[model samples]
Each structure stands twice: as C-alpha cells, then as structure tokens.
Target chain A: MTDSSQVYVREVGPRDGLQHEQTWLDTADKLNWIEQLGEAGLTYIEITSFVSPSWIPALADADEVARTLKKSPGVTYAALVPNRKGLERALLANIDEVAIFLSASETHNQKNINADTESALARLSRVAEEARQSGKAVRGYLSMAFGCPYEGKVEVDEVERLAERLFEMGVTELSLGDTIGIAGPKQIEAVISRLGRMIPLERLALHPHNTYGTGLANIYAAFQLGIRRFDGSTGGIGGCPYARGASGNVATEDLVYLMQTLGAKTGNDLVRLTSSAQWIEKRLGRPLPSSQLQLSKEEGRCL
Target chain B: MTDSSQVYVREVGPRDGLQHEQTWLDTADKLNWIEQLGEAGLTYIEITSFVSPSWIPALADADEVARTLKKSPGVTYAALVPNRKGLERALLANIDEVAIFLSASETHNQKNINADTESALARLSRVAEEARQSGKAVRGYLSMAFGCPYEGKVEVDEVERLAERLFEMGVTELSLGDTIGIAGPKQIEAVISRLGRMIPLERLALHPHNTYGTGLANIYAAFQLGIRRFDGSTGGIGGCPYARGASGNVATEDLVYLMQTLGAKTGNDLVRLTSSAQWIEKRLGRPLPSSQLQLSKEEGRCL
Candidate 1:
C-alpha cells in the first residue's frame, strides 16, 4: 500500500508561474494570493523571485510581495535568487528560504543564463557559501533534470552530478525540475531511484511540468520512490515564452485533488484551492489547466 | 524489469467510439480509418457492431464495414452484439469474435438498455451462450463498472458480482467501462486488484473517460494491476448524451503515447495514429480529444 503521509505539496505559481505572465501583478494582488494559498493549507509557497526586473518584469516587485505576505505560523515562503546579488535582496526581505536554480542542460544553461552547466554549478557554490554565512537555508533547483527541450533525452548521470555538487555546496534540499513538462512516470521513477541512492529522501523535492499530461503521474511516481516535497502552480497560469508553448507547472488544485484522493494528507482545503485557482484563472481571463478545479466546479463540489 | 513485450493494445475507436457519434461516419471514412490503423500495426481493432441500425444510425453499415475489413493475418476483429438478435447478426457476419456489454449499475443499465442490471446480465447470458455455441469467442463489457454518470460511485461488490456472473455466463474476458470519467487511479486499482484475485490477468481490459483528466492515470493504475488490454477511441469521442458528457473514451493517441513511453509495446505508430486522428477530426469538424496528436501535429510530427 502507498503511504499517505509522505507527500508535501508546494505551490510555486506565484514565483514560477506568475513570473511568466505578461500582466504585472499588483503588490496587493500578489499578497492576497499568497495569503489565500497559505490559508488554503499550502505549507510552502514560493512567494517571488529576487531576479533583476529586466529579466522577469512580473516579479520586479518581489521584495514588496515578500514583505507584505500575511504569514502562517509554519508556512515556508521561499524566494528565487540567481546569485549573490539576488540572494542579498531576498535576505533583506526576510523570507523563510532562498532557492538557487541552474539549468542542467548545457544548451539551456547557455541560452537561459549565458553559462554552461559546470559554470552554473560554480556560481551556485558561491551563492550557497554566502547563504550559509548569513545563516539562511539554501535550496537548489536542477532545471531540465529529467530531460531537455532542446537536447531531447538527458543523461541521469548529468543530473546526479549536479545534485551532488549542490549538496556538496551545502544546499539543504534539491528540487529536480522537469522544466519542459516531459517527465513520464518511468522517467520520474528512474531519476528518483537513481538520485534516492545518492541523496537522502528528505533532501529531494520534485518539480514537474504538465507538457505531456503526466505531471501528477510523475508526482505519484516520485511519491512511490520516497520523495515527499513537490511543486505546483495554482491555476497552471504560467507559460514560459522561452519554453515555447510548454506549460509552466502542474496545477495546485489538481495536485492536491490527486494527493487527497490517494489518501495522502496534504492538509489542503479542496474548496479554497478551487476558489483560488478559479480566482486566478479569472484574473488571466483564461481557463485554468487544473482538471480538479474545473471538474469540481461543474459537479458543484465546493466546501 | 517490466516486460513491455507482453502489453497488448486493443483499438476500439471505430466500434466503441464511432457508435455514439452524432455525425454518422460515412462507410468509406470508417474503412479508411480502420485500414490506416491496421497499417499502423494495431493487432486488435473493434471494427463495428452488429447491433440494430434503428437504434444506432451512426453505425448503420456495421455489417458492410465488417465484411469489407482488410483482414490482417494475425489481427483480431471483434463486433458488439446487444442481444440474441445482435448475436445472430454477428454469427452471420464473417467476424472473428463477439462482444456483449452490461451495465454494473441498475440506473445506468435501465437508462442504457431500458432494463435494470440484473435483466441486462440475464440478456448478456443468452448473448454469451449464443456466441459460444456458434464457435465464436465471447467477450463481456461491464459498462459503468467504475462509476456511473447517473448513479455516482458504484459499489465494488456490485461490480464484482456482475463481472463474476458475466464470466460464468460463458464470457471469457471482461472489459470494465467507466461510463462517466469520475473514477480515479485508486478506484481503478481497488476494483482491478479485487477482480484480479478472482479473474485472470489476461481476461481484463479497462475503459476510462477523460472527464476528470484521469484517463492516462487510470491506464497506469490498471497497468500496475497487470491489465494490458484497454479500450480507447481514435480522437476520444462519444459520451453519455443523457449525462451531458463526462468527456468520452480516452484518446487512442494518448494511450499509445503513454504505453510506448512507459516501455509497453503497443506496435501502434504514434505518428500514424496522429495522422489518422487528425484526418478524421478535420472531417468531423470538431477537435479530437487526443492531446498528443494535437501537440504532435502542431509541431509537425509525421510518420
């Protein structure tokens, strides 16, 4: 039987998904969504990114969004930071944690960050050192961990090396991201099974994309492999122009629905999640990518 | 390691999918789709039904469709028969096997066949007997086995009893049809595992709807329970018109993509599946529910 307690879902739509939206999220609106997510029992919400405004205009107000969040007692609010500069900005916002992301694929790394995979790793080491000195928790994200959109299939060893280097650099946890939504169940299990042997289960969180409609399947695969933490979007609103029509992330309501149905304790209120998902989908004036929210609405399944 | 070679994909789009279409497929169009499916290496294709044309005008030319099949050497062509009259029609047709469907829920059975579940099972008994005595293999279809659109969440005992009765009625195999798409992975596993203990692995097939977007997830859950056979439509069409659609059958292209990516041998070409799906979709003037087919076509995937 699958254990019910091991899955921990994190809503990353505000940081990962919203960062891709063309419309600028007002500071109050961003705070309202963050608070709503926290009240909906989302323990971890990636609040915003501390990246340069020129790179991600939607999140240019990351500091204000971070500062204005009505925090829950145990909720962890994480901020995405590219390097020491971004890290310094995030620390000033007094966020709960900071996440460092780098592309594992050489092509994506060069095109995305103007650095090869190794050079990105070297930068992460310096960032991790600064975070350690500041007494702040550093989390690492290995983008394109399962496969690369540009390069097709990725070597498992390449991902393992990146994970090992991040761990060696003193990052507390690693979130393996299928940036292009291409990881199927077998691939998710293959990567987790291989990585589980190298890193402790507690140190791994899975971030999957819904490009091939296997996002939840991949999450379940990781759950079966003893990984607990995962990442999702609220309405699945974020689309990466860079990823080229690829979906941003799995929908939060959909993820929670699958988990709750599978007997996993996410402590998430399905009704509020639906509202939050619907609220944002309305904000975007588009249909949400979440099957649960949409189906629940149709079936009148509200709390 | 899971032996991908053991998986058998049964293409049922022509019979199960097209039977309920509002826009009746032209005789030539059905033949062309079947031929393309055969050339794509699909070993089992449910060509058409021998049911009364008065009831289902969409499949009015079922007899001719069966007679004009390409007849690949090892391929299996099965026809659906609703009663003794339908079975008699199939017995005369040059078809290989006969299929009979019964609803697992009383309300669904009543709505579908104008009889309750018991009466439907009783009728299926005579249909199975007639097909058996004629030296043709009898396959039982247990519709609404998972969840009924009319009566929500069917009892497992109710389904098991019906399935057991059908098996005892000279029916060698059972295809569990989720009439509505409300069933999830856990529900699929719970029933499949309970039934698997009593029924042989090779004797089971799963039919799921994309209503809650659990079609692919249900496929994996069944796969975990050792079920290799599944029913799907080419573009994922047909639904309970009375129920106002809980989506329809899972898309054949999506199913093929899932099975192939999970290392299961379907022998069906993804490229060809997309082309055939697209061709019919254009003719129908409505989008087929095959996500991968749409994605692949938009991205210029070709055989």
Candidate 2:
C-alpha cells in the first residue's frame, strides 16, 4: 500500500489458529509464533480467545500466551471474549482490544450461546458497553452475516440491524463474517454495500473463510469498496469449531500476496510466510489449505 | 439469463475429465456418463479426444464411447484433436465438432506439443480449416491464455492476436484458458475486455481450471461481461497434466450451481448431477471437488 490510507491485516493465528489444533501447541511454541508474527509487521494480532477451556482446550494458555509476548510498540493485540466472564479473563491479560461475537442467523446464535438471536444481541450489547467502560476497544463480530451453511441464506437486514446496534453499544467496529466461505464477489458487494450504508466504512472489517477458495476474490471486492481492515490467519489457521467441513480462515500468506500485488501495504515476507506455513502444515499432518502456499513451494515451476 | 442472450455449457469430462485417470473407464461407464450429461441439458459435450493410445490409454475407448451413445439432437458432441493424426481419427468417429488446442506461452506450447506458438498455431489452423471444410464447427482451445504454469504471466496482446488468428482460421468459437488458475476477476476482465475489443463477444468463451479455486469467480466475471460459453468437467475431473499440484477443471455441477443462483438458465438437474458426481467420486477414490456437491450432501448445508 503506497497510499497513506493503507490496509491493516489482523493476524488471528494465536486465537483462530490454535482453536482447532488437534495437537496442543506448547505454550513455548505458541509464544514463539506470536513473537514471529509480531516481528513480521502485523499491526493487529488476535492472541487468543477467553472462551471456556472445555470448549477450546487448545487455547487454555491464552493468558500466558498474551503476557509472554514482547509487544511490538504500535501493534494492538485483541482477543475474543463471549461475555462478562470471558471479558474478565481478557481484561486480566491487559489486552489492548477485545471482540464480541453474535450471529445474524437465529440457529447459529441459538447453538452458539444457547440463546435466541434477540437475547444474544442484548447480551452482546451489554458486554460491549461494559468493556467500553473499562476503556478497552471492543469489536463486534457478526458471524454468518452473509450466508450460513446451517441456515442457508442470511438476510442482509438482520446483519445490518445487528451491526447498527453493536455500533450503538460502543463497539469500536463491526466485522462481517462469511462463516462457511460461500460468499462470492457479487454477494460481497451486496452485503458490504448494504452494510456500508448502515455502518461506517472505518468501523467495518471483514472475516472471510476460504472454504470455496473464493476468500482472496471476496477480499478484492471489499478492497474495491474501500474496506481497509481484514481478518486473516497464519497458515490459514482456525477451522470452524461449530461448522462441519468448512475451510479455514483465509490464509495470511495468500492475503498478503494478493494485497501486495493489488497495492495494499502489508509488510510480510512471502518466503518466510510460506516457510512458517510449511512448518504449520507439518504440525497439522496435512497440506496447508492455501493455494498460494502450495503454488509458492513448487520451485522452478513458472506460475 | 432473462436477456435474449443464451449461455452454452460444454461438458469436457470425457476428454479433459478422464485424461489423467490411470484406471481406464469401463466403456459402458463412459457411455453411460455421456448419456447422463446429455440428458442434463449440456449444449456441447466434448465426448473424447483422439490422442495417441500410448499417451492417454485411459481415453483409448473414445471411438467406442462416441459410437455407442444416444446423441441428443440439439447437443453438439465435440472431440479434441491436436494434429492431423488426431483430427483424422476424430473425423472417422461420430464427432459433430473438433477442437484444436494451442498454448499461449511459447514454453508451454513447446513443452505441451513440441512446437512453438507459431508452429502450433499453424498446425491448429490447418486442422480447423480441414474440420470446417468437412462441415464440422471447429472450437479452438487457447490454453494458458491467462497464465502458464510452465511460463508465468501470459501477454494479453499475444492471447488476443492468437484468438483473432484462430477466428480467421475458420474456428467457430474461442475458449480462453486459465490453465494454471492464477487468474482473478481483474485479470479475467483484462483478457475478455481486450479480446472483446478485437473479436466479437459472440465467439468467445472461458475454460477455467480451479487450481487456485478462483474458477467460479472468474466464470462470474466472464458472465458479467456477456461471454456465456464455458467448459467444465463432471466432478471437477481433470488437472493440467504438465502443471503438477495444479487443480482439476471446475466441476460442471458447481458451475451450474453458480449460474442458476445468478438466475441464469441451464438445463441441468442438481440432484442427478450430484449423484453422477458421487459415482465418479467413488471411482476416483476421492470426494468430488465441487463445493456445492459436498454442501448438498450435508444435512443442514446449502450454497
């Protein structure tokens, strides 16, 4: 990004990355990767969520992972906190930002927090407001905002109403979630255009899964629409804990590759990113769910 | 499409789909699939190729497969023919159309056909002229027109020049290739926009491989630009043989999914298409690569 108005990539490996890790990441390895990502020039990093340990045992050392890292001066670290209990734990970690997630789909909300959409929104609003009182910036994640694999097509009005309510509740930003990676450019345009009317562009971020492998293309659509913040995972970490057969979050390396090519400023080394991804691939006992990572490693192959 | 314009979907599974399979399809299975796809309202079914048996013995049953099927009256059964030898063989079969392929990159052309771009063009032109003289509509396959796996970024002028030359060679239509599948919407626009300027949109089509999984999105861009004809395989069948690690062609069912969702008309039945995909998936010992196929089988999922 040569322009002063550049995009920021929020690295979600620490939280989204380890959530689905079959093999628990040793605290040392977690801290090591966190430190590396910090040095790699990520302006925003999501360290870990303060969700229940039983739900995500992989992130049990969330507080330790947060405290062990040497903070990159200008970088902000955020964590996902479900409600008051999760927020208390995140507050103890002294994180710069916290995120509250609520679903646009009623079923997802019912399953997510065991509350209906209305109740989930009320609880999320309270959490965001209370977190604001403590002077911590809160981001509201509206999951299944585009289309849920569970519920099929989610209404844009439902997404917009929730986003407006979140913004009113003192949340710093609204991140639209395409949980199952079913969104395309047209859908992105439709949802974002509607949300852009309801919410401020600066207050909007996007979290797109690469399930259908359209993550990068969807990001381009958002970029064209002047969206400057996006959520990505290192090595495409973090499979959906709730959704079955869903792809991981958009690969950080692929995001960087597309952004850098399209003139978005992200100070990530392609070679190092691919190597780190390869390391994660080995740990996961599978190929990285990143087309860019695989394409990069095929040495001497022209494309 | 609500417009008077119509889109033609060419099924390339028989030729492109089975080319990489080591397991030679039962001649009966091949014939059954061709018949099934024809019933699905495919306008142009690429039945088989007349390549050397030594190179692609999996498709050695092409002659038998072509002669045995019940040809749908309005549907064109096209065959891939690389040179004079392949063309002669295809002409002897029940082939309604013959497609000649020439690579855009000199390196790809040399590696793929042991001929440079010019020589390969000359050979294809000669074959196209011969097929036209025999009253067969000749479709030209311009491989790697977007990007070559063997030679990175292909030039638009070169692609446009070759496409124009192919038109002059008595070709019926052109299918621009995304052989390596590195193309995004902007690149798709650049190619079609340039080609649309040189040649009429009526004679243009897109043949995208899903290596990077942007095939559907690229197809969306193509449709948006008023270029309707496309090539896809059942169950996302074939990958570029030379481009190791690259993905197979986009699945016909998945393409139909995108087209139908956009409110375009296609004569394919999703349920039956899904079943056919599953049948091939069992034979290939892998799940179908189409996103919609997997999503469909999941109890709660929909695309």
Name the runs in model 1 displaced over 4 angstroms.
A1-6, A22-28, A239-248, A297-303, B1-4, B19-24, B49-64, B67-73, B91-93, B149-151, B239-247, B297-303
Q: List model 2 lDDT by residue over A1-303, tens digit each.
A: 245348778888778777877777788887777777777778788889998899889999888877777788988989999889988888888889999888889888877678998887788877888788899999888889888756889998888888888888888888888877778777888889998886778788989887665677688778878898899888787655433434578888778876764656777776777777777667667555565665655544432
Clashing pairs in 1: none
Give lDDT tens digits, candidate 2, residues B193-284.
Answer: 99888687878889998776567767877887888888898888885444434457888887887776566777777677767777777776
What does chain B score (TM) in every candidate?
0.93, 0.93
lDDT of 1 by residue, A30-72 (tens): 8988889998998888999999999889898988888877889
Instruction: Give the alpha-carbon lDDT of every model.
Output: 0.79, 0.79
- The candidates score, on chain A by TM-score, as follows 0.93, 0.93
The prediction achieving the highest lDDT against the true structure is 1
Categorize the docking of model 2.
acceptable
